[model samples]
Target: MKKTMLLCALLMSAFAAHAQESRQDVSISATGTFSPTIHGATGTYTNTDTSLGALVSYRYLLTPRSGLEANYSFTQNTPRYVVPGTSDNNVHLRQQEFSGAYVYTMTFKRYNPFVEGGVGAMFFSPIKDFQTTQLDVKRTTVLGGLFGAGVAYELSPSFDIRAEYRGFLGKTPNLGHEAFTTNRYRVLSMPTLGIAYHF
Candidate 1:
C-alpha cells in the first residue's frame, strides 16, 4: 500500500508540473446570425431571418494550447412558414444560447488560431404580436451542437482582437405549432468580431 501511494503521488506531481501556467480571458463580440432555409419533405418550407446578435465568452486555459470556454449569445430571429397557397406569416423569436466548448489553440508569433466544438442549449421565445399568428404556440428550448474557428491578433500583453465564424446545429423550432414544423436539422451561422481582455 505504501508503494502504491508513493507512485500515485509521484505521477500526480509530474502531471501538475507539466501543466502550463493558468490564464483567463473575457471577450465580447458583435455578431450576425444567419440561418438557412429548410425545404421540408412534404412541400413545406421554413426560413429564418438574418439578424444582429452579441456573444460573450469566458475562457480558462488548462495548458498552453488547450482550454475550455463558456459562451452566451443572444439574438432576435423571425421564422416564416410558407405552405404554397396560404398567407405567409412569421414568428418573432428571441433566441439565446448557453454553451461550453473545448478549445485547442495554435500560436504563431502574435497570432493565435483556435478551433472549438461543444454542446449548447438554444432557448427560443416567440413574441405573440400582430406579426405573429395566434396559435397554440409557446416558448421552446432545443439542444444542439456548436462549433467555432477563429484567429486572434495580439495588440498588447493584455488585449487581442478576435475574429471568428461560429455555427450551431439543431432542429428547426416549431414554436409548438404544426404549421411551423419542418422536420429538418439545420445550421445557424454567425460571423463574429470582437476584442478580448486578459489579466
Candidate 2:
C-alpha cells in the first residue's frame, strides 16, 4: 500500500512539472500597419492614398491553444473628393481603435499559426487646414468588429516574430455630414508585421 502511494505522488509531481513547462502566460507585441483607400457615400469622398499605422497588443493565455488579447491602433490618411473638376483639397482623416479578441493558436515546432475575432470601438476625426472651406468636421465614435489570422515563428523560448492580416468592419464615417447619409458599412484591411515577447 505504501509503495502504491509513493508512485502516485511521484506521478503527480511529474505531471505538474510538465504542465508548467508547456504553459506560456502572457505576451506583448508592437506592429506596423498598412491601410488602403476607402470610398464613402456615393463616392463623395474617395481616399486614394495608402496609409501607415501602428498597433500595440497584449495577450494572456487561457490554455495552450487559446488566449485573450487586447490591442490599440492609430491610423491616418488624406481623402479628397471624387469629382473631376474638384480642386486639390485634401483633409486629414485619423482613426483610433480599441479592441479585444479571442485568439486560438496551433503550434508545430517553431511555427505557430493563429486566428482571432473580436469587437471594438473606433474614433474618427477629420482635420482641416486653414485654407480649406469644407464644412466643420466632427469627431465620431462608432462600433466596429475585427477578424484576423497570423503566423508566428519562435526565435527563442520567450521571443517570436509574427505576421498578421486583419479586416475591420464599421459604418462609413461622415465627417462633413453632408446632404446624403447613406449609412453604409465599410471595410478596412490592415496587414501587420511585428515581434512579440512571451513570459
Candidate 3:
C-alpha cells in the first residue's frame, strides 16, 4: 500500500509540473527516420528492406516545459521476396502516420533534452509491380507508442538544431489474399536530425 501510494504521489507531481508549464507558445520541428522492415510467416525474418522518411510536428505549448504535439511522418521501403516457383521480386511499401502526444522539455546550459510519447493510426500501401493488383491496407485507429531522447543546441530563442532517436510500434492488417492471418505488427527505430522553431 505504501509503495503504491508513493507511485501515485510521484505521478501527481509530474502532472502538476506539466500543468505549470502550459502556457502560450508554438513550436515546429522536422525529423527523419531510417527503419528496417520485417516479415512473419511460419517464423519471422528480416526483409532486408530499409526505409527513410521525414516528419514535421507542431506543438502548442501549455507551459515552458510541456505541450501538446501533432506529428506526421512519411516513409517508404522495398522488400525483396523469393518463392519456390515464382520469380524473385521486390515489393514496395509506403507508410504514413499521424499522432498526438505529450512532450516534456528540459534545457541545459547549451543543450536541451526531452522525452515524448504518443499514440495514433498508420496507413500502409504495398505496390508490387509484378503483381496484377496493388495491395492497400488500412488499419483503423491503431494504437501508437513512441519514446525518445533528443538534444537541442539553441542557436536562438526561436530557432535551434535538434537530433533525436525514437522508436515506433504499431500494427496493420496484411491485405494479401493468400495469407491465413490478417494482421502484421510493425516495429521501427528512427534517428532524426532537423531544425526547430518556437513562437
Candidate 4:
C-alpha cells in the first residue's frame, strides 16, 4: 500500500509539471474506490457485498467533447450468503481488469458531466470452504462490458473531486450457485467516489 501511494504521488507530480507546458490532452490518474454489489436474488440467500479497489488510467482527449480512456483496476472480496442448518458460506473473488472506453465529457461552469462505456475482461477466484468442504473450483477469466456516468467538480487547478457509477457484466463457474441451485450471470453495478489530479 505504501508503494502504491508513492507511485501515485510520483505520477501526480509528473503530471503537474507536464500540465504547465500545454495542458496535455492525455492525462494520467490514480483512483481509489469503494464498490458494493447487490445481486438480484431473494429467498434464503442474498448477494450483497462490498469491495475496495484502485485504478490507474490514461485518458486521451480525442476532441473537445469526446475522448478515449484506458484503465486497469484491482478489486477483491467475494459475496457471502448464509444458509440454515449449515456453516456460513464465504467466497473470495478477486478481479484484475483492463478496459478501453469512449468518454463524452460536458463542461459546465464548475462541474463536468461525463459518460463512459467500455469492454474488458474480469478474472474471478473462488474459495470453496464457504460452500462445501468437498467442492473446489479453479479460477476463471471472463469477458465483460461496463457503462457509467459521473460528475466532477474542480476543487483547484490541480485537483478534482469525482463521483461515478459503473457496471460489469460477466459469467463464471457459479461462484454463488450450486448443483441444487443454479445461478445466472448478471451485471454488477457499483458507485465510487474519489479524487484525481490532472497533470
Taking all chains together, each candidate's TM-score versus the true structure is 0.86, 0.76, 0.69, 0.67
Candidate 1 segments whose C-alpha is farther than 4 A from its true place: 1-22
lDDT of 3 by residue, 1-199 (tens): 9999999999989876764454433334444545444455634333435556787777786766787888788887654444335454445666677888888988787687888888776665665554413343222245668767788787765567878877778653343433313246666677778887655
lDDT of 1 by residue, 87-151 (tens): 77688879999999999999998999999999999998988877776456789999999998999
Q: What is candidate 4's lDDT per residue for 1-199, written digit by digit as tens?
A: 9999999999998877665442323333333333333333433343535567776666677676787878777777655545455655566666677788898999897798999998987776665555434244456676878788988787866667777877777653345356213244657666667776665
The best candidate by lDDT is 1
Which clashing pairs does model 1 show? none
RMSD of each: 9.3, 6.2, 12.4, 9.6
Off by over 4 Å in 3: 1-41, 44-48, 81-89, 128-142, 176-184
* CA shift of 188, model 2, Å: 0.6
Question: Which residue pairs show collisions in model 4?
Answer: 15-199
Query: lDDT per prediction?
Result: 0.88, 0.72, 0.63, 0.64
- Residue 150 alpha-carbon offset, candidate 2, angstroms: 0.6
Error of 2 at 10 (Å): 19
Give lDDT tens digits, candidate 2, residues 59-78.
88888889888888887776
Q: Is candidate 3 or candidate 4 better by lDDT?
A: 4
Error of 2 at 142 (Å): 2.3
